[model samples]
Target chain A: MGRYFLSKLIQSLVLLFGVLFLVFMMVRVTGDPAALMLSRNASPEQLEALREEMGFNDPALVQFKHYITGAILGDFGNSLHFKTPALPLVLERLPATVQLASVGMLMAIIIGIPIGLVGGFTPGSVVDSIGRFLALIGQSVPNFWLGLMMILFLGVRLGWFPTFGRDSWNSVVMPAFVLGLPVMGQLVRLTRSAVLEIRGEDFIRTAHSKGLEPRTIYLKHVLRNVAIPLVSVIGVQFGYMLGGSIYIEAIFAWPGMGGLLAQSIGWRDFPLIQAIAVFTSLIVLLLNLLTDLAYSIIDPRIRYGR
Target chain B: MSIILQVKDLVTKFYTLDGVVNAVNGVSFELNEGETLAIVGESGSGKSVTMMSLLGLIPMPPGKIESGSASFNSEEGLCDLLQLSPEEMRDIRGGQIGFVFQDPISTLNPILTIGEQISETLIRHKGLSKEQAREQTIKLLSQVGIPDPELRYKAYPFQFSGGMRQRVVIAIAIACTPKIIIADEPTTALDVTVQAQIIELFKELRDALGVAVIWITHDLGVVAGIAERVLVMYGGRPVEIAQVMDIYKDPKHPYTLGLLRALPSLEAKESKRLKSIKGTPPDLLIPFKHCPFASRCDYAFDRCWEEIPPLISVGEQHQAACFFDLEEGGPRHD
Candidate 1:
């Protein structure tokens, strides 16, 4: 188990560094930071000074190493637009993004799993039909459009909640629902298929033959079996959900990392963008690793096997 | 001997998109108390379905128990198992009648520990408290002959070898001291050596606990070793049922004769190669109006195709579903 953990940790580190290198190189390849930051009419002396300050004169590897060291020390230079340390600027927005993303995920899991389970257990029932219909719209219909629709109907039309900005708990609901709907749809589909497949397995027959309560058979036996697939989907969905939330945040004007990301990209704030990308990649990699660990827990073969 | 369970004209079917599949057609048999009754047939012969139907384990949609009456003299009372409510069936299952299915690799839940699986039955059916169930579970583990019962109890199904896993499945089946234990090809998935051990384990468990067993298998060899009475199923119905000795000594039905001859017997050594029954099992979807084994039977005639051969008394405590009498070496009228 320890060996498995060590190997997984090493793999995650390699992946993290790979993302770090790609994002770092991408920011450099787009345009010279020194030139992008300065006006076109700037003198050579001024350009040289700015270039030197930004470490643009140094070799790419040396500059990357300097950036890496600075990142390690929690100093990712300063956001050009905000004139604040890029790491801190990204960190400040982390809580809001975390809150929105987690709420979106929690909502997806809590609502989606039961719907999928019911649909899987009874494929043609009314509950099953309703679940599939909702999942279809959730998956096929663009979430940004859904967000806009909510704003128009729920926010603007009826004035049930504020149209924009993260002020109260009510503000989080509309944006979070939009952000979560896609993953919920995916979960519903995945869970339904998973339950349908598991229902036919030999162990399920054994469970049934055991005279176990239907609740016990499904909740204790089938659901635990269903969990591994659900966990992996959730892990993969986290990356997409977090990535998509940027647009969702923009629509609802929720002050999360997504807004920071959009603003940073528009202003060509390399440090801020790099910090957020690195942080997001680390989280995603960590989640994938965690997903792998969860597999061993759910299945003993992995935990105890050589 | 008291008939613990008697199934009559149990017909199970599957309502598929294409058409209705007549999976098990008029399967009827009696399981005596404290005796191993082997239900023998090839794959897709509905050996498992017959037993599963009685237990109410068949899924409602697509698969359904079309018509049946399984009178079981359970601990609760003599009730038609087919008519029992799902809740009642649940109570009878794993309590009054235990079932150990084929493929232990897939039968046991991969996530749950061996101890937990066994204890689940004890707790549910036996009404044992967690503490009592755990203690009983440990005993069952040891009873099934696993080494280091205490340590092994905590291990999952994958941790055990094929033989050991089957042992765990058997342990769960017998955990509640059920009146009848239906083991559907329990040894089919194990190696030859392991198969012998499982058969031996079944014999011991049956003798010790005095639990009637319905051992379902296609292997006549295993049946000869363990079964007291043999039920030969062809297509979806029983062609013959008799004392195990009578089945081996003087087989009645042509299908049973073919099955006995197919075995690698000492008397058949001069034959060079073992005899195989010709042709596949009948297509169950079309429905059977004639003998299911007619196409494959050596004694098949015009009458064999004209109508279904119902079970008829052939000898003392013996029945065969065939128009031709092998004893007389000719066809017999109704």
Candidate 2:
């Protein structure tokens, strides 16, 4: 177990470095940061001073080395737009994004799993038909469009909920649903199919032959067996939720890292963008790691190097 | 001997896009207390389906029991199994009739430990408390000849070998001390040596507990060795029914004669080519108007083509479903 954990840690470090290199190269490859920073009407001397200050005058390798070392020492440069420490600014927005993703995931699991269970157990039933219909809608409808629809229906016309801005718990509802619905739909379908496949397995029949109630058989044997694959989907969905939340956050005015990152990208704030990119990658990687650890808990064979 | 379970003209059918396919057609049998009745058949011969239908294990909608009755004598009275509600069927399933399936690895849940699987049955059917169930589980495991039962109880299905996994399956099946145990090809997945061991285990359980066992298999040798009486099925219908020794010695039906001839016996002086049954079993679709075995039977005639033969008595305890009498000579092919 210790050796496994060490190997996983090394793999994570390599992934971190890979993300950093890709972000650095791709962000620079698009356009010159110096050109973006300097105003169109700026004097030549002023532009030159700003370029030198920002390390554009240095060799690319040398600048990369300095950036890596400084980042390691917890010294990401100040954001050009926010005029604040880039790391602090990113961290400040981290909680809100985490909260949104967490709530979205919670909603997906809470609602989607039961729907999937019912759908799978009774394939041709009305519940299954409804589940499939909802799943189709969820998969086809884009997140931004769903957000707009929720705002138009619930916020504008019905006046049942707030349209935009994260002011209270009630405000988180629309954005979370908009972000989570697609994921929930996907999960429901995945879970339904997984459970259906599991139900056909001989072990499930054995469980039934044991005189176990249908609900008990479902909860204890069927769900536990299906959870391994479901966990992987959940992990991937979680990362997508973090990354995909930007559109919903922007539309709903949610104060998450997604909204903050979008604003930084619009302004071409290099430090803030880099910080947010690294932060999001780290979060996604960590979630995947946690998912790997959880596999062992779900199935003991996985713990013994499966 | 008093009959404990009786199946009368049971017809199990499956509805597909094409039409309804008769899987088990008008199958009838009876099981007395403390008897071992083997239902022998090739693959897709409805041996498994007949047993599954009795327990109401066949999934509804796609698979349904179209007609006939499965009556069991219980405390309430003679109950028709087909008439029971799903809840009532559940009560009879694990409580009275235990089932051990072919593949042990698949039969036992991969995620749950052996102890939990066995104890779950005990708790559900026997109403044992958690601690009591655990104790009973260990006892049941030990009963099935599993060594260090207490320690092995915590082990998962994948941890055990094929024979040991079958033992775990047996332990779970017998946890409630069921009156009737249906072992559907229990040893089919194991090696020859392991198969003998499992077969011996069944005999030991039957002798010790006086439980009636319905051993379903395709192996004629196994039927000869373990079964008291044998029901030979072909094309979703019973071809012959007889005492084990009688079936082996004076097999009456053409299908049974073919099955016996197919077996390579060690007692033979010279090595001879074993007879193989010619042609496949007829398809169940299009409503089998003629006898199911007539196409494959060497003794088939014009009469065999037009009518379905009813099971007729040959000896005191032997029966065959064939129009031609085999008492004159061996069966003559047209």
Candidate 3:
């Protein structure tokens, strides 16, 4: 187990570094950092001074080496637009993004799994049909459109909750729901299929033949078997939620990393963009690692080396 | 001996897109107490379906029992297993009658421990506490002849070998001391030597616990080793039912005779190659108006095609669904 953990950790590090390199290259390839930093009307002398200060004058390899070494020490320079350390700027919004993602994931699991189980257990039932209908809308209808609908219905007309900004608990609900709906849809389908597949298994018949209560058979026997794929979908959905929340935050004015990201990209804030991308990649890689570990724990048949 | 369980006119069918598939049609038999009854048939012969339908293990919707009544004498009273509520059936399923299905690898839950799987029945049917169930689980595991019971109790299904896994499945089946065990080809997936061992285990359990067993398999060899009475199913119905010795010594039905001929017997001297029954079994989608075995039977005549032959008593404790009078004509060749 320790060896498995170590190998996974190493793989994550390599992935993190690879992502960092790609993001760094992308920021550089797009446009000049100095040109974005200084105003369009700035004098050539001022632009030159800024470029020298930011190490744009150095060789590309040297600049990359400097950037990576500093990143290793948790230094990502300062955001040109905000005039604050990029790492700290991203960290300040991390909790809010984490909160939105976590709530979205929690809601997806709570709502989606039961629907999946029901739909899967009885494929042609009313509950299954309803679940499939909802999932269809969830998957096909864009989240941006859903966010707008929620805003128009719940926020603007109904006055049930505040429309924009992360002021109260009410604000998180709309954005979180919009983000969770698509994930929940995917989860419903996945869970249903997984359940359907598991239901056909001989072990299920064995459980039934054991005279176990339906509740025990469903939860302990069936659900436990369904958990591995369920957890993986959750992990993948979390990463997707993180990436997809940018538009959601913009629509709802939720002051999360997504908002930070949009503003940084618009302003061409190189350091801030790089920091956020690296952090997001690290988190995604870590989540995948955790998912692999969870598989071994959930199903004893799955061992690391053997 | 008194009958432990008696099934009559149990008709199970599968609804497919094209048409309804008649899996098991009007199958009926008796399982006597403390006796081993083997239901023998080739693949798709409804042997497994008959056993699964008896336990209510067949999933509804696609698969349904059109008509049937299985009367099992439980401690509460004699009740038709087919008519009992799901809750009542639950009490009888693992408690009164245990089932060991084919493919032990698929039969055992991959995630749960052997102890947990065995204790599940003990807790539910026997009402044993967790601690007592664990102790009994260890005993059951050892009873199945696993080398180290304590160590194996915590082991998963994948950790055990094929024969060992079947043994664990057997352990779970016999856990609550069920009156009758319905084993559907339990040893079919095992190696030859292991098959013998599983057969031996079944006999030992039957003798020790005095529990009647309904062992379902296509292998006549395994049946000869374990079962006393043999049920030969052909095309979703029982074509012949007789004692083990009678099935071998003086086979009556053409299908049963074909099965015996197909077996590679050590006593045979002339023929180097084993005799195989000519032609395939009939498709079960269409209704069987005549004998199901008519097309495949060498002795099939004009009467065989016109009407379904009922199982008539040919001798004491022997029955065959054949129109021909084999007594005077003797065995016919193609």
Residue A217 in model 2: lDDT: 90
lDDT of 1 by residue, B191-211 (tens): 999899899989898999999
Top-DockQ candidate index: 1
Which candidate, 2 or 3, would have the higher TM-score against the true structure?
3
**Runs in model 1 lying further than 4 Å from the true structure:** A29-31, A293-295, B266-271
lDDT of 2 by residue, B19-45 (tens): 888899899989888899999989989
Candidate 1 vs candidate 3: the DockQ winner is: 1
Q: Pairing residues by index, what is the TM-score of model 2?
A: 0.92
Task: Tell me the whole-model lDDT of each prediction, alpha carbons only.
Answer: 0.88, 0.86, 0.88
Candidate 1 chain B has its poorest 10 consecutive residues by lDDT at B265-274
Residue B255 of model 2: what lDDT? 88
Error of 2 at A188 (Å): 2.3
- Off-target runs (Cα >4 Å) in candidate 3 are A27-44, A57-62, A303-306, B267-271, B330-334
lDDT (10s digit) by residue, model 3, range A114-220: 99889998898999999999988888999899899999999999999899987887778888888899888998999999999888888998999898998998888
RMSD per model, one decimal: 2.1, 2.9, 2.7
Better of 1 and 3 by TM-score: 1
**Residue B272 deviation, candidate 1, in Å?**
2.2
Ranking by DockQ: 1, 3, 2
Candidate 3 chain B, run of 10 with poorest lDDT: B325-334
